[model samples]
Target chain A: MYGIDSSPIRKAFELARTIENPINLSIGQPHFPCPPNIIDAMAEAAREGKTAYTLTGGIPELKEAMARKFLSENGIKYATPDRILVTSGISSALFLLFNALVNPDDECLVISPYFLMYPSMLKFYGAKVLTVKESFGTDDLNSFRKKKIKLIIFSNPSNPTGKVLSKEQLTALANLAEETGAYLISDEIYELFDYDKKFYSIGKDYDKTITLTGFSKTYNMTGLRLATILAPEEVIKALTTLQQYTVVCAPSVTQWAGIEALKTDMSSYIQDYREKRDFVYESLKDFYPLEKSGGAFYYFLKVPIQDEEFTKLAITSKKLILVPGFIFCENKDHVRLSFATEWDNLKRGMTALQELSKELAN
Target chain B: MYGIDSSPIRKAFELARTIENPINLSIGQPHFPCPPNIIDAMAEAAREGKTAYTLTGGIPELKEAMARKFLSENGIKYATPDRILVTSGISSALFLLFNALVNPDDECLVISPYFLMYPSMLKFYGAKVLTVKESFGTDDLNSFRKKKIKLIIFSNPSNPTGKVLSKEQLTALANLAEETGAYLISDEIYELFDYDKKFYSIGKDYDKTITLTGFSKTYNMTGLRLATILAPEEVIKALTTLQQYTVVCAPSVTQWAGIEALKTDMSSYIQDYREKRDFVYESLKDFYPLEKSGGAFYYFLKVPIQDEEFTKLAITSKKLILVPGFIFCENKDHVRLSFATEWDNLKRGMTALQELSKELAN
Candidate 1:
């Protein structure tokens, strides 16, 4: 009966509701609406009475589409439709995988500044979580090898810092997972948001890697809640069984829309996010200690004041909402600012953040 | 990591898929399409760009509507919007609640023949499950009192049995729960299908009751996957936090449709199910030992032979799929037959079942 506290990001959402016309840079989802064609497809599915439960894993059409997406795009030839288990979202896939694999007191390694759900869910299942910083090199492998880690997990084109891992880094991590007999879990929900076109799937090189990607972020259909997991057939079977008892299946109409989503090109949308990412990084780098975000629409800015204090001040003085970095990791000096808003709001939010930092420095 | 096997129901579905023209009496969901108006509302919501993640518990609109439904129809006065958690489905609601409440080796009581997930989920959380027969009298309370059961869960209009508990029976269970300090979870997903007009919610008389109901059965939207749990505010908060890390939120378009589902009248659909229930029961009662289902469009008929053997013969000889009772309970002398199909299918399926039973009896 251990209790889980609500995430601080939700508290930020609550705080934003109190502000009038807040320049909110705290959302993790795309600002754009889902494409019209995908929406129409979903509506058509409902109208055509495709509103009953699909099979436990998912409909064959969606799984086949995902299998092709994995092989052609991700370079993972082993991801046949049988190896893909469609889930409600990557969050649920992680939930199911963690439940299937992590036992009490099992050592699990998570890359630092991880997606908030990763640590929270692992701990919920009683895993002893060991976090390795995002900047870990090949030398980091030697230390973790002795721990016999059961699983290693991280989100690519990372959520808070938007730092995409290099191919060399991914290879080293995969090698480490192999040495330690640990399953690698790659959360590639931000795959399509890679501004530098440098995104690589660890699953392409590793047999034990569990790759999770979904339609939510790429298509701006987060509410539809559909995702796919490419894994070993044994893993897929276990997760599908878990899904049958948990989520049952992903939403049927949304699964239908996912077929259309795979067909809809998102290059223009990705281009817009790339421009926004560049704008946010360029505008803030001189004012604050920041790294250029290579992918995803976020800039983790190191603020002059405490992250929480600075966030509060920004909301109070400038009506801006930013997520304090403590919720994502142990870095209280950094605050995560999502550039996934309108161009006007992004500019206003960035300017407000600059003015607040100047005031705090003075 | 304990492995969970796929349920027998899924195996039945897989077997049904292999047959050319299977009469799927084993299917748990309604055969009817979702109402056109509800489907239209879902489509309209998607078209309106309501396709982003909602608040963890659910949208305020749906929760408010659920609160109204609970208060007016269920006589649950304390179920304000804040006390309700919208989940992917009742299965997910059960998952979250079980994760939140059940500790390792905790004692849990389930009334048998229970929904398969009840025992499986409880055991997944390491509960020592105690089953009280469905025909348990008030005297049965004395035996369970000493067991120190932490929770008691059962579906009203029970999934396998379809036997709606009398008000006295519900009161006795509630009183037993009160005396033992155990939380009572009343899954009322089939509340609308109470053919006897004898449905009663324990939440009306008990403070510790958690009432779960959903639109899946009433609106014929099993694939849309939306349900609500009316519980204490503290319990709701915990489940909501868990949901945020798991399913994230119920599908957004479906949540909008839920508001419409609440408004649409479903009496005609319930009447249709009632008639179908009568048709199936009357047709088979003389041939087989059957209890007329009081709710939820199912009959648990005592079979003339072993449950599995009878189910196999029916499927082989008659292209009929009936669920063996062993999946739902310890009894092997019974099978569950759903009467949720069309009039033609129900009639044909009933005749086939009757012939199969006679052949087996001979």
Candidate 2:
């Protein structure tokens, strides 16, 4: 039988489709449409007849731009184009990286509250997903020392938690990985959304680090489905080969759009997300025990009732679409709320949450 | 450390990058640019801001068109959208299908002179690739009864061999698979390129048959990275879940373009490939013992010298690019040449190959 259907997130989405007129704050993509400039560039590519497969890894221009971005933006330096791979998305890049490094029966380290896909995908690969239920704590880092882990994977400016790992924390994890001869695979897809702090990529300092990030979140082109992975030559080679037998290459027309996206001044987009972050923080700070996350578009709030029960009640009573926190981890007392929507939709969803809070208080 | 670097096809491509202005008969894509109509459709999608993620399976319209296309063109009928999955390409569809059906150590049957990716990808998933060294013979069908195969995967309009499985042979394979409880996956990407015989898809006659085909060869949209997998519900659900954690969905704008592509009359494209196939067959029939293939755009010829030796001599002496036979299997007597290029380029490569043949005969 297909094992993924049993997962809580999958079940939640299945339940979601049955409800009528639901306010969906469950998706993890930017609510804004992709900018006109980026869209125009893609159209221009289509007009210019640029719709053919590039080299398996990437187009030369995109690769060069990505390399330059790593050095100037993420503060990571690479020697050549061989060190980078343009992927179908951050998701595809992660899939390939995990397959390259992990084997069946190998324990792959993951931190929970995590993205729903990590454990599910690792299970598909027949690897033992050893979930550590803490942030970047040194104890959690040290706890896995005796166990042979194929890789330690986490998202910075995290998916559910929106907890950005500190520079010192990332470096410590990097050092631990190097010391243990294990690879550190980081999903930095939300790197551009860090509001309070400047993001630090562990790949900047670590040789064994494989960084997965892309244009989707930063450029609001999730539908375009284009991203990149940066790693050393050995890992890049492995991922590239896997890619050839898989998606072959990123969408060429979208890759051209990505070049335009990188060139565009997206200060406005980041500034807008920062404002939404503040608005959501102010709206919910009193209703629940919550953290003002530094980056990404999600907030994990400890709810008054069991998370799944709360989700069921919200869906049945208010038609509010939200994911139970237990889907991300074993934490049954929380729910994840995404602020990646327009202010109007966010306000409507929050109003329903406010009513739910009052009804529960009664 | 990268396992794929050692594969001969990968090595051949690597060797290709170094040679200057080689007469290339090695590429496997159509030489023509994507038709202007399809390009216009994609640009229209971008202009309309359709560059966002669709449901993991695909957009509703595209799925409907695919279901209709399968019924009318391939003679396979599925009741609903759930039976069809739009993939990044046939390559990604096969990758997802194999991961769903197999685990490490499970045996999967494949034919020799197969597409390079089939066995290579199976190995990546830790599946045992049992490559049968025969064409579609019912006698060879019994060869796999002793082993419990997870699936039997092959390309119709075969890759290197260019040997299209006749309707009778396909029906026999379908029956054998059903009796043996093995899933049959047919790669019908080249169905449109068939010159003589009408293409027969095993999916038409069998319930468990998984069909992998796409718009790449038919429409010259390989760069768009769009394809489909038509299978039963149980497998469709599994593949859909795998897709969510891999590439989220096919590129959104391209899927719109796909809808347009399906609606357009593509008789002219087929007419062009038919002529090219005939030209290659007529040109090479006398020079070497070549099979006049009914479908696909490749010619597998038994060259006079050892395949690797011939390939090396041709590349170094004449600056001609070609793949040796042993790359697909251990058959050292042949070489695989693609006629997917325009007639002028094909003539140039064939001329070089002809001179080399004469020199070898001397």
Candidate 3:
């Protein structure tokens, strides 16, 4: 049995539940309710008696829709329905991919400030996880290449830092993977959250890249639990077999709703988050050292004191919730603040964070 | 990376899809569609914007309801809400349990003929799986004790055979587990399908037993993907931590429906399967050597020829789909026949099966 600690994000969530009227900037999901049409689609599916176990991979219609989305949207031409494996969520996809690829003591490279699941899950699978902190430049790649990394993974429109990789950076990583005989996993769950139109999928240029995108964040249906994986045919085959014993299949009604999700546009919603990101960045840049996040909903602010201690003070004094940065990477001087809440709540959270930073300075 | 072949049950499903007007009996889920009340409950949950992720363990109301059900119905008084871990399905519950308990080369005893996933999944997790064929007698226990088995697992109202173990038999197994220091996993997904009312849950008397049950079999909501685990608090804690990465949580809307499911009675639906089981048993007993199933909706028949070859003949000649028994156990001369289909289709399937037996004998 492999033992793992409960994630610090979950601890923050539990703590926030105890405090009344918390300004919860620690949430990982979108604040918006799921669109009415998508909800209706799933309800209709259930009413129509489409509530039995689906094929082990997924329903054909959803898989076909995902294939089309990958080809026209992500510019991946090889993704057919057979090559697309619909999973419960991106989390489940990561679980399946890791179980299928990671061998005991296999060297795996993760771009740091990565999704917390990457390092934790890889280590559980007995992979020797090597972190390349905050850089995928040529030098970082050269240093990592010596480890003979079997797998390289990172979230695009990154999680804690919200730093979307440039095309040049993605190309460097892709080349490194190809030269070292490693598979690249591009977690693009936050692709729709890109603020500056700087998002680039490595799968478009490299066939070795496995592209993971999902409807949870984009449609605010995190509970519905649907995601799609575009990978090589052999990898898809292996994952499909693994999924049979694991997820069995994604929810049947949710698979039907995914067809409608592909048709629904979330550009307006993304625009709102872009404005929120700008507001948080501009307000805090003078008070604390922070970068204008290119995508996702988080701002990793460098704190004056230790990240955990600062978060504790924020919660105790201001009734604010923030995730300490030590969980996401090796850094202890940063904290992640999500702007994915309501506009009024976002404003209140920003004010609380500003006050906390000033207090820490004193 | 672990390599496993696709299950024979899945192979039969795939083959059935290719044929027209096939007498499909290869399914492992309930034949009934979800009840209207349960469907409405889930729809209401989704409409009320409860579509975001719930806590990894589960929502409070559903867990409490499951705890109550365990106490009143199964006599498991220790199954408090904190000890219940909601999962995507029983398959996922098995996945999490095996991953949490089975270290490399651990000796695990599986009661056979078993659920196909037991042996296959244990092997994938690097367990040295030991199968006790068709008996759990004193002799079997004595032999198994010598191997130092770390885990013992089986489904109550056994799949592929539909043999419900008596209370005495369950007590003996629990005693063996206690004496040998092996933890027992009782997969009671088919407990509600106990037509003879002879189902015995080991958790009622054994604190070391992990009881897995779900709404998928009872409510005909397999696609909704909700199951629960009752175990020792420490085991629940470890599984809960593992679930955070694997399943995350059960579907949000489904978890709400599960609360409604516990309130609803399912005896009428179970009675229908009881009639189906009797109908198939009486129709084919004279033609093939078989034992009458006490619960669940399956009959394991001794075929006159190879199980796989017999199944192929039935499919080609009569459009009947059946799983070969070799997948379930070491037996090669038997096949599993699921009677969980419509009355009219069941009649046609029995006639086809009888004719195939006659042809094979000739």
Candidate 4:
């Protein structure tokens, strides 16, 4: 279990923190501060001494707000807070859901270019991850009918690739899940980051779908450690059972911050990320075979050399940090460049990437 | 499994929350504010935008502070941050440590009346819990020497019982672990609540011991969701690997608060709880077969009737909430009353308890 390389991102993050004037494109942290209102809400909650454990599932107010969000944003109506489980983060939400749904030797499906934690958490629970050689939005599970996947965990508005699932794709996924009696677990943390297409959640159509999203990227509050899981009532109950032994609840003060965060407008941050996505595409589009970033602030840039070599070069020579795509997927042909840092840092990172690409060409 | 009745305390908490002026002694929350410095530190952290994910183990500042604490307070010298892991809470810390240490069907020893989550989490991991019918401080491990126990998990300055482990008991356990190649996990979350005892952590003597403690009880900041594990370097490394996928890291803002919390004086709060423990023991001693309160704010009071029935009667008739001892142990003969509420509420809860005892006797 400890064999998994959980260190690359952390290593890069650590290296970035130490180097002077280094451009850190390795992590997907929001450039802006946590919304002032939400931060104030947390401070206010602490001042009010709201520092005791909430119910194992979550605070009622945060769950209620999250239910409201599920109805308005995703068209999925959770009539009450019973179906929502506030998690420490999307990371922990996935951990609990996998532990709740998975058993030893259970076959779970994952799409290629998946998040690292998906396989790691599944493996921790003694479940096997069978990867489908399909893109995030366009999943082809017909061949895997014999595999009998108990659950399918994949990301929408994909990390590393920034691919958003189409509504039709989500509909197909919901239909397949219902047909196969397998649950579709969608992680939509990047829903608010989508630029080209409307964000679609399979949970809208599939009762078995569990959509995980959080305040991490949307409010630039990853450190606040608040996330939401909207699932079938039974699934939520099961997850809460595991969480009672895990977190008890998301931090109470942060849940209060989440209550306020749901009320704050994020149009400005959304528009700004859309602009940066466009800028990153235009800047590196010429030399690197970078995909159009539809949602998340990342481009899985196909490097001229092996991703590991280029990442090392970028770190040592150009003082730029990028994650090798092998951590995200089976292939090591690409390095993920994140444009979620400050404008100055992103610009400097782009220059380093361009230099690395030029040097590799010679 | 979701079959476990996880809602007894929550049910009482919900009931208590709804009724105006209800005396709630159900949850183990401290009836005090977080130290002012820690609260200010958290607010300051948010203002400074320290809301991004830190290293998976913890922020370096917090880990360093914890290492310092291990040496100064516990007299166990970590000498480096590598041996300390900052977790979301003692709850999450246990979840990670068990994931890292306990294997499926491993024989783990638990002292009777162990913290509820220990067996729950161990069971979640498919480990068998072997209860040693002994008090927290005194254990007879001679019979268990032949049983190949992989680990021993128990609480010191225990929650329901408020029993502080003696130095000789810790030394014997440590020696047993060393001799048998079994690990000793000492949960010292209640370390600060000890009334007339000097808390002696097993890790001070045994390197094979992993000592778990946290800021939640010590600083009256359970909502902060911060804790520490001082363990062997290898165990810390393994747990860090799991935490990367579990919580990612303890919340960065709270870690800042923890840094300040490490420096704040907890003498006043400790003294306050000590006095409350005394007040509670004095008031309830003649009525219930209550032991003299030693540590923590709880007393495992023997009831005249079955604890569950008496608990229900108190809640329904007197608008008081208390936890039955069966939640902590196999017996239904006792109820656990917490003196961690405000003095007025605690006094009221005591009155309710006295009345319930009289009524039950009749």
Model 2 residue pairs with clashes = A223-B52, A223-B53
Better of 1 and 4 by lDDT: 1
lDDT per residue as tens, model 3, B295-346: 7778888899899998888898999999999989987988888888888888
Q: Can you give the lDDT of residue A25 in candidate 1?
A: 93
lDDT of 4 at B231: 82
Using lDDT as the yardstick, the better of models 2 and 4 is 4
Candidate 1 Cα misplacement greater than 4 A, ranges: A1-3, B1-3
Tens-digit lDDT track of model 2 for B20-119: 8767777777777787888889888877878777788899999888888888987887536788899998888988887788778988888778887787
**Which of the numbered candidates is closest to the native, going by highest lDDT?**
1
User: How would the candidate models be sorted by lDDT, starting from the highest?
Assistant: 1, 3, 4, 2
TM-score, every prediction: 0.97, 0.94, 0.97, 0.95
lDDT of 1 by residue, A332-355 (tens): 888989989999999998799778
Best by DockQ: 1
What ranges in model 4 sit over 4 Å off? A133-140, A145-147, B18-20, B133-139, B359-362
* Candidate 4 backbone collisions, by pair: none
DockQ of 3: 0.74
